[model samples]
Target: MVESSHHEKDEALAPAEMLALVRDQQRSVEGQIAAFVPLLLVAWGVAWLFGLGALWLIDGMRPGLTVPPAVAITIAAALFVGAIVLSAVLGARSGRGVRRDAATAFPAIVYGCTWSLGTVAIVAVGLGLLANGMDAALARIFFPTVLVLFAGLMFVLGAAIWRAVPMLLLGVWIVAVAVAAPFFGYPAVLLVLAVGGGLGFLALGALSFRHLSRLRRPLAGGRRG
Candidate 1:
């Protein structure tokens, strides 16, 4: 009886070891993604979506802003570089989780709808700014307030709902642009938005939307190790 019981324990240990080994192999495979190309992809995502329109505000590109062109350029460049590093690190990191069903897919699907509607509003705000010029009260109120508010929302959403690294960073930059806008003027602020906001979103949206499922797959398995 003792020998028989010991044999059963050994048999159970074999399958457990096999599962652990397979999980480790999966993590190894996923770690390989943290490379040069993935960083580029992350960089692209950030620039297009969030930073595209805002870039017009940067110095040299437009004259209305108060800050010197060189200073503005330096700030913008730093943000770009930082965003790329952050996104690449997040993307390359891997995890495991249970696979999703139709219900689970809804969050990603619905998130875009708000973004779509908000885009129209964002475009209108831009048009308003351009059409109204610097003197208009609405432009004064709209650009800083609306943009800051929007950025905050996106930051929260990116951090909370989507857990999107690019979006979260984009949100931070957006808030920064809003703070700088009143001091620098729309020209400089707009440039900041373009480099960080428009470009950030475009790049992030592409990367997150495309790779989110693949990235989430491992997390669902509940086995990071």
Candidate 2:
């Protein structure tokens, strides 16, 4: 009886079983990688939606009541800062307990640094242009378009790293919005970012949540089986 039990335990899984196991593992890994994406997207969506929307309202792009631009800008800046802080905390938390070789960790480190450095560069350049007599109206357009374009490029790079099609699509959408916002001119450009870019992020976040739910269901069913 002991020998018979040992033999059974040592037997290889059937081909179908092996394939199913592989697929389950793949889903698990995908879920882990994607787990934080929806939250991040939603957070940014809120920031862009209400934050940029407030800016749009103050810009007097349409004929209606308006708030102080300073007030709108301050609220937007606060929301953006909150999002950035949350992203950093969540990103760091997600990597905990994951095995990290230099090859695997290097890209993430570099990518994080790129965001910091690129943001600084944008600020410096904007300030330099302003000091050199760039018009206030132009400055408003320059800052948002350049910042949004930079974010889009970073998203594309992240998609390449993770092989996530949804992320890739989001990046493409952001790039399109940034490119097109300029044609709408000032204030109106803000509306484009608020409505188009903001709504896009929220929509993608919802879809991603649904996808993640579907991914989890199979894994749960497999475990039960």
Number of the top lDDT candidate: 2
Q: Flag clash pairs in model 2.
A: none
Which 10-residue window in model 2 sums to the lowest lDDT?
A: 7-16
Q: For each candidate, how many residue pairs have backbone atoms clashing (under 3 Å)?
A: 56, 0
lDDT of 2: 0.88
Runs in model 1 lying further than 4 Å from the true structure: 1-9, 18-22, 25-41, 45-99, 125-152, 163-170, 194-225
Candidate 2 lDDT tens digits, 1-225: 999888776565466788999999878776786789799989999999889998988965455678788999899999999999988888877766567799988998898899989989998999999999999999999999889989889999998997878888988999999999999998899989888889989999999999889989999999899
Residue 97's lDDT within candidate 2 is 55
lDDT of each: 0.57, 0.88
Q: For model 1, how does the per-residue alpha-carbon lDDT over 1-225 read when each residue is reduced to its tens digit?
A: 999999999998999989977876665454444233345555554543334333343333435654554664565566666775665465445313435587866885676577667857886867876776645544644554465557557676856785656657767766765565555554454544455545555555566545655654675565654
Count: clashes, candidate 1: 56
Against the hidden reference, what TM-scores do the models get?
A: 0.47, 0.87
